[model samples]
Target: MKFISWNVNGFRALQRKMDVFAWLQETGADAFCIQETKLHQDQVQFDTPGYFQYWNDAVRKGYSGTAIVTKNEPLNVTYGMGIEEHDQEGRLITLEYENYFLITVYTPNAKRDLTRLGYRLEWGAAFTKYIKGLDQIKPVIFCGDLNVAHQEIDLTYPKNNNGNSGFTQQERDDFTTLLDNGFVDSYRSLYPEQTGAYSWWSFQFNARQRNIGWRIDYFVTSERLKRKIVDARILRDVIGSDHCPVELELSEYYGRHAGR
Candidate 1:
């Protein structure tokens, strides 16, 4: 099964910037998870004839949100972590499949001024616990804009971003704790020594052209699902939003890619 995850920045805006439907048609993925949609469901006008769409919109308009467009309908679908305070923004949506759970999350960003850093840390810890609980039931494939670049190599200008939101010690450590707990970051697991492969880039200083970016987006699966992971990719070239897509292809019986 091929599962692709992207923080599309804003799905509504990208519709005009690029053809979202055509992009989806070419990927041939079982499911597409997106974050930072910045739009309420009523605002989106997508009509992918075969896909079942699920939207988790934030209570605050034009802010945080997420989505999952899948070819097959999930057995059960859930929104948010059930933690009322954090659920208000519609930052999570988990689709339960027979073999696994697919969670699309848009982690809270620690503002540029670092004003939201404390809340972000709390959210991370809660989210970590939330996923671990799901892992107890079955394997889980979680992805989206995690907002933190775990290592120096994960981002450009690590030294300069050391104290910054995405690279701060606390954020990185939280991610480390997650891996230490059991999940495998599929992209890094497949290409441990690779570099300059990023998913999100700065809109400033012509960063994308220079290839200066941070790989905050990810496809993290339970360690038990590692061998089933056939391939993982960072689709840096197919850009519509500031963030590009990251895909994970699994040997089939999982979905449309099921007959291999």
Candidate 2:
């Protein structure tokens, strides 16, 4: 199955800039997830041909949000992490398919100079705990703009960005702890030493033109689903938002594993 994820920056903005429906049809994706929608349900229409859509809009409209558009309906769907404090932003959504739990998350950004680092650190810990809790039940297929570059190789100006919000030591360490808990970065699993593979570019200083960006968007799956990974891709050619779409092609069937 082909599953894809992209941080559209803003749902309405992207819809205006490009034909999102056309692109989805071209990809033939079974499931499509998006982040940073920056819209509430009232501001937009949730219609897309051949797809059942689900959304988690932030309590604060025109801010962070997430959505899942799938060809097949889920057995069950969940919004946020079930923690009131974290649920306010609508940053997470989980779709329980027959064999796996597909989680789409938009992790909180640490902000410039780590101003929000404290809260983000707490979020990282809680988020990791949350994922581990899911891992215990079934191998997971999770993706989104996690907002952190886990290693030096993940961004262009790594040395200069060492202590920056997205590349900070604390944030990186927390992400490492998440991987340590059994999630594997699916793209890196196939292209281990590949470079210049980025998903999010800055709107500042010609970052996109120079390809100076971070590989923050990801398709991370539990180790148990390792063999199901057929391919992972970065859709740099597609355009609309500063972020690009990342995809994962898996062999795991909907009901063969932990499907409901």
lDDT for each residue of candidate 1 in 1-260, tens digit (9 for 90 to 100)? 88899888888888888888778888888899989999899987899899999999999999989999999889999999999988999899999987789999999999888999999999999999999999998889999999999999998789988989888999999999998879999999999889998998889998999999999999999998888889999998987878889999987755433213
Return the TM-score for each candidate structure: 0.96, 0.96
Task: For each candidate in the order shown, give its overall lDDT on alpha carbons.
Answer: 0.90, 0.90
Alpha-carbon lDDT of model 1: 0.90
- What lDDT would candidate 2 get against the real structure? 0.90
In Å, residue 47's CA in model 1 sits off its true spot by: 0.6
lDDT per residue (tens digit) for residues 37-148 in model 2: 9998788865687789999999998999999999999989999888998899989999986667898999999889678899898887888998899889877889999999
Scored against the true structure, residue 177 in model 1 reaches a CA lDDT of 93
RMSD to the hidden true structure, all candidates: 2.0, 1.6
